[model samples]
Target: MIPFDLHTHCTLSFDGKSSAEDMVRRAAELGVKHYALTDHVDLGDHADPDFDLEATVSGAKKLLPALREKYADSIDLLYGVELGQFVHAPELAKKLLSENDYDFVIGSTHNIRGYDDFYFLDYKEYDPFRLLGTYFDELLESAETADFDVMGHITYPLRYITGDFGINVDLSQYAPIIDEILRALIKRGRGIEINTSGLRQKFGRIFPDEWIVKRYRELGGLILTIGSDAHCTDDLGKGIDEGIAVAKAAGFDRIAIFKYRKPTFIRI
Candidate 1:
């Protein structure tokens, strides 16, 4: 049984299709006892200038408590936000995080400086190595300063490189850069996530794959969270069993669940 899924998105996110209620119900059905609804929060350059967080935050306030109480007997629910590019908008990011009582936060950089998310861009147009180099650089910068329990999808841009474009990315070229990011998170007592969404995507492989997980373990990085990154009900808890196997093979006997931004390890 998949005990927990720490990263998820519901309709509160701009691109998500499932409701928190539906996601929660599906989790209970799948024997996932602990679940977190971490909708997206992209401030500043990550979002348009006029994009508002108020509506998203307000929706969360009304939905989370109701779902938590309704599922209290069957599931342990936590409210979370996946905040992007905090390094690009520290003041605004901190303000939004401060104004709400989020149980967990995921720091990510979906975009480079002036570009949109790699998902929206045409990967064929850019030099694969240079593009991923920039992507890793931004991730390193975010890791240096974003306030969050874990970094979401440590190798996200790879989705575009290896998945969408069907290009084989030489991860070796960026190992030193990735190590820098892992070390920064370790220094701050933060963690990284095993995002299971990759299984359903064209990549057909886990993000960062098993080797990265092994490297993180070798580096003394202890905190890890597993997630489906599900935007719909059918995908809920998907690949998490493999996620657990990955963690075990990487030397982790347990994974984490966050409450009030603090991690509590759960034995697998």
Candidate 2:
């Protein structure tokens, strides 16, 4: 059984379909002992300019207790938010994180230079090597600025670039940059996730790539988490077993789960 799924979305996020109740029920069915509802909190250029950050945190706090009680005996639920890096909104990101008591926070670079480049950017024009290098740089900057508990989807852009485009972006070529990012994350006490969502997408490879995972372990980065990044009920726990195998292959003997902001390690 999967130890915990720290990255998932319910109705709390913009694109999610399941409610917390449904998610809890599904997790119970899968024998998942711990889970986190990490909804997206976009800090990009186009997010509702007047969005109430305080209210968002308040709402999440208010809902956690009820959800926890409802699923008390079955599974543990963690309150989390996925914060995207806008680069320009560093202060806003810091403020939101400072004011909230999230059990876990995922720092993601969904935007570059205030633009939503995660999905909108075309991968064909530039050299794949250069593009990936730039992406890792941005990720490093985001991690340094936000100082979050975990780095979300370390190789996110690959989800859209590899298969149909037939671009052979070898992750090993960027090992030095990858090492820097992993080292920075380790220095900041941040964990990297095995985001299994890529398995269901065109990328066909897990985040951070296998080589990055191996290097991370070698660099003394032991804090690891597994997640589905599921937007719907059916996607929950998808490829989690494969994720565990990947982590074990990378030399991790345990995976982490969080509760009330405290990490509990589970043997793989």
Each prediction's TM-score versus the true structure: 0.96, 0.91
* TM-score (C-alpha) between model 2 and the true structure: 0.91
* Candidate 2: residue 178 lDDT (0-100): 79
Please provide, for model 1 over 1-268, each residue's C-alpha lDDT reduced to its tens digit, 9 standing for 90 to 100: 6799988999998878988899999899888888999998886565745446788888997899788989999999998989888888899888888888899998877888878887877866777688788888888888888898899898888787788888888798889998998998889899999998998999987876788888888899989999999998988999999899999999999898999999999998
Worst 10 residues of 2 by lDDT: 110-119
Which RMSD values do the candidates have, in order?
1.5, 2.3
TM-score of 1: 0.96
lDDT of each: 0.86, 0.78
- lDDT value for model 1: 0.86
